[model samples]
Target: MAEKKSSALFVCLGNICRSPIAEAVFTHYVKEQNLSEKWIIDSAATADYHTGKSPDRRAIKCMKRHDIPMSHKARPIIAEDFKNFDYIFGMDENNIRDLKRLAPKNSTAKIELLGDYDPEGPCIIRDPYYDDGDEGFEEVYQQCKRCCQAFLNKVS
Candidate 1:
């Protein structure tokens, strides 16, 4: 039989910032480990405020600096997503609560905080949209990198 591709959906309050970065970082990390072909990666938001909008400009720039190409449109978490993804990672506790609330009782996705996978640092991927400059964005990138690496190691 053909091998099944594991899928992951990264999420935050809005898709523009943290979630997209996490999605991009995880995608890049998987490719670096030569497991990209075995995985399906994407991102979304818990709210529809930025639906259809592109990832935040700061996030785009951060990915550029890392030489990781990223292109994604904002979208809210949907019921179908609960069934489609094998894993759904939220950036913070609020996201986890919202996702749990939105998910159907029979939903198959394993919902959890992405930061929980971090070996070091805070267990929350703080929102940087309101922060000054790119420092917050950079920190998000670093956290995502660490979390993604650790998460992948445990699952794969």
Candidate 2:
């Protein structure tokens, strides 16, 4: 039998910051663990604020510092994402709630807190959009890395 495709969608208020970073982090983790064949990881925003832009410079720089390449373009999460993604992870409670609201009643079960996978620290991965410097970017990157690892462990 063919292997099933287990997909995940990471979401934030604006795709330019947290969500894209989560996408790259999670995708990198899966590839590192040799689980790439079983998963299709991606990301989106609950809002369209940066719909056509690349990830925020700080986010890109953080990923580059860790040698992770991010190829996803910012986009808004649509209703059909609910059907295409097996799991929907939100960077914060607000994004989760927004995605849940757009989810088809039957697809509501797929939405979850991104931090649900990270039980030890804070549950919400803070947005670095308003940060004054690189410090917040590094913090977000570290948290995203932890969350990705936790997610891989659970799915593996």
Top model by TM-score, which number?
1
Q: What digit string (tens of lDDT, one per residue) describes model 2 on residues 61-143? A: 88899999998789998888888898999988898778877887666448888887775779889888998898888987888
**Model 2: which ten-residue window has the lowest total lDDT?**
100-109
**Candidate 1 pairs with clashing backbones:** none
User: How does candidate 1 fare on TM-score?
Assistant: 0.97
Clashes of 1: 0
User: What overall lDDT, based on C-alpha atoms, would model 1 receive against the true structure?
Assistant: 0.95
Q: How well does each candidate superpose onto the true structure, as a TM-score?
A: 0.97, 0.95
Candidate 1's C-alpha runs over 4 A off are: none
Reference-based lDDT, residue 108, model 2 = 42
